[model samples]
Target: MRSKTLGKIVLSLISVVSLGLGAAGPAAADSAPTAGAPVAGKTEAAGKGGPEGIIGGETADSSRGMAALHRNGNFLCSGSIVDNRWVLTARHCLYPEGERIPDSQLTVRVKSLNRTSGGGVVAVSDSRVRTEHDIAMLKLDRSANAEPVRLATANPKVGATTYVFGWGRTCATCAPSTVLKRATMRVESIDADDVYGGRAIRTSGLNGRTCHGDSGGPLFKLVDGQRYQVGVVSGGNAGCPDDSGFRFASTPTSLTWIQNVMADF
Candidate 1:
């Protein structure tokens, strides 16, 4: 169950406290550099060695329209397909405030755990951002032709086991991995006072953590063996790789907005 009603003042305070937290570390390059390759920001550990959840948690499969995005060979962020041509992610991945990057600069990969290989690739033709909750959608120039992941309709119960997927840095100071990763987390709370209408889902890592470059990744709940994406990676504390902090995300609390955006597109 969710917490009691929170006034706008409390919600504003929570939003302020959550700000400045990053989704993950900066992205890593897609290929190994020969020499003098520009090293991106540290912490792109998208399953560098082991995932950021329960230490021995198994890696997740890529059958659910999982995608990793890149720009000029540098890993950008992670996302999932919600429609034939629409990809869901965090707004910060493609924009700075109100500015949206041109679609020509972005590429999306699907159907592969290896970010560098094995997935079908497509160019982004457009993007839409909902800054209030840090959620966004990208329109692919062509269909990925893969089945999109199902979105969760109801609120995930507190204490329920959930999973997160991404291509973020393996640890706080380590380089970002090109392969996709998954970790298990437990629902901690619902930010009933979040400025975005209490859409924030706070989750505790079981064994692994979400580090750099994991922004826009998916938080999923399994229902009777099927995957339902319930949240989008948003912000968390800086104590990554140590497994001591909680990560927050945008969830179906804004389902109406998500549906509205998809319909508009």
Candidate 2:
């Protein structure tokens, strides 16, 4: 059963204390990364690697918040392969703001994700979730079959590096639209004490963070030969300049929750 209330909060969330929080990390991290993949993160939204890059440096000090979005005019979000057929994402992405959408109205694509370019496509079969927990699982018609990202079994750690990917607005404190976007962000920390503590990464020199189209994106880390998905793009403070990056956070990683959900499969 869902343990918390999952709803959309379009409010701008900054890292200041007394804000909100979301359990950015999830069940998948307990495993490992995709096989023979880069040890660094390639967290992006739409297709395979959405709009993110390796965490070479940091970005501005701001952020944005959003739900599900598109990539190259295709329906997709930052998702990760969990188990043989389930792809995990934020509850809001599957059910934006926790609002449910008819299953028929939802689909997924994991092909070539390019904003400047474009590439492959995969169709999701079904979806399941724990709304209160801010988590959802997308059932793919076929398994990734290739090197797929896994989740962490480790406990949520403070100062741990968290990655984020999405197609939201490119600026913090700016207007957001439902367009395909992508970027690699960092997790300054996972502040569970805050209202929606999904503290994610910020750009190093940019004045913005995850925007509107970024919701339901992937958050991962490198392990072994693959990328291990740990969180989904949630929300954050938007509206910033190119010099002051923005904020973006994900859900926390929980072990029991992941095992329980995947056991059914």
Best by TM-score: 1
Residue-wise lDDT of candidate 2 within 44-101, one digit each (tens)? 2222222232111222121122122232233334455555456666555544333455
TM-score of each: 0.75, 0.56
lDDT of 1 by residue, 1-265 (tens): 3332333222110110111222222111111100000111232222224433212233454435677666544566777788878888766566422355577877777776666666577888888866555677888899988778888887688898877777665654444454566777778876532223336777777757675556677778888877777777665554253443344445576677778888888
Clashes of each: 18, 82
TM-score result, candidate 1: 0.75
Task: State how far residue 16 of model 1 sits from its true place (Å).
Answer: 24
Native-referenced Cα lDDT, model 1: 0.57
In angstroms, the error of model 1 at 202 is 0.4
